[model samples]
Target: MDNRVLYERLGGVFAIAAVVDDFIDRVLSSPALNANPLVREAHHRVAPAGFKYLVTEQLCHAAGGPQRYTGRDMKTSHAELRISEDEWQAFLDLLKQSLDKFRVPLREQGEIFAIVQSTQTDIVV
Candidate 1:
């Protein structure tokens, strides 16, 4: 029985970073997410490259890669935004689009979805 981690299965940090880049771009441009003033302000204030770097680190860590995420935790980072269920759903939709664009396998996508979903309680108000 093989026991390869999700990070290896997904082709490691580079692949994960590519997905994160697209996902972050989609999220930053989302009208639904930016509708919240707090979200809008943060999106505009943060440099896109830095945002992508943090997100890539986080995703790599979550996917069981060697990278350690140095950014703020999910709750602290998102708390002020007052994210709603609708916005969260929109974010997930964007994630799905990004994964689909990269042709991530269904099994891997499910694993990634579970990892992201684990943060739902912290992210959604």
Candidate 2:
């Protein structure tokens, strides 16, 4: 019901987009992530718009955007990739770097990280 909470949660779509851009840039630049064929050629180019929407919608809902996440499940999409532990760690590290690079506040970072972390098992297995 509170628009301001939603705004704060979402941080505006542009803010979320900025963070995503930073994160994706870092991920792309990281040798660990770039080395993966799925990421390098397939996932990287194709996933951004969906990713952005995912973040925006989740943040908006978490922060109080109205839209519920009815998207495809994570495990289904990521399970086949067979991501290794090292690569998973690299993904997380770059994610942290991206948030830090953009100066996302600690609370916000923690919140976002927690939300993202929820997908780890599905994504990494």
Candidate 3:
């Protein structure tokens, strides 16, 4: 079975998108994260749909789906962000809330979280 289908059976890309959107919003609003301030570009604020799309693309590929993410590598993309452990923790917190809100089963949540976590190498300061 396609990973996308499995993710769909679990919830689908839309579900992941929704969670990511909420997570981004929460992260942007919370100052508890000392590092990794919101992206300065006006575009990132006015509309995160593009970022959301890229996130989903990365996710689909990470989950063993058919889609491929041709976007910039995490290291290159996040190089300028200068994210820190606190900011990364904030992201994880928001993601946890989203997963809980979505009521994703534990097993599937772990799989998806693991995929999101794959970027740790680049996301951390």
Candidate 4:
């Protein structure tokens, strides 16, 4: 069995950051997610680079990398946006697209999905 942590398997910070960069760009440009005025406003308010940085940090930490996530909790970050089930699914679809773009293997995708799923309750209102 492969003994390396998910972070290492994912090629550590650089690879993970690349994925996050794509994912965040996809998210920020998604009409489905921005349909909600609150979400649209939030997306417009945040700097894309900083948003990517936070997401990369979060994923890196979740995947057992050395970086610590310094962003707010999922609930606090998403609470006012009031994300819906459909919107959440749309977000997942974008995530899948990003992972596919990176050619991330099934195992790594599953692990990443698990981490994202764990935060769903906090993110979805």
**Predicted model with the maximum TM-score:** 4
Full-model lDDT for every candidate: 0.93, 0.71, 0.70, 0.95
Q: What is the TM-score of each candidate against the true structure?
A: 0.96, 0.75, 0.78, 0.98
Clashes of each: 0, 1, 0, 0
lDDT tens digits by residue: candidate 1, 17-87: 89998999999999999999999999999999999999899888988899999999999998899999999
Ranking by TM-score: 4, 1, 3, 2
Off by over 4 Å in 3: 1-6, 34-46
TM accuracy, model 4: 0.98
lDDT of 1: 0.93
Q: Which stretches of candidate 4 lie over 4 Å from their true place?
A: none
lDDT digits (tens) for residues 74-103 of candidate 2: 887676677878898998898888878878
79-119: candidate 3 lDDT, tens digit per residue: 77777777677778888887788787787788877877888
Tell me how many residue pairs clash in candidate 2: 1
Q: Candidate 1 regions off by >4 Å?
A: none
Error of 1 at 75 (Å): 1.0
> Which model scores highest in lDDT?
4
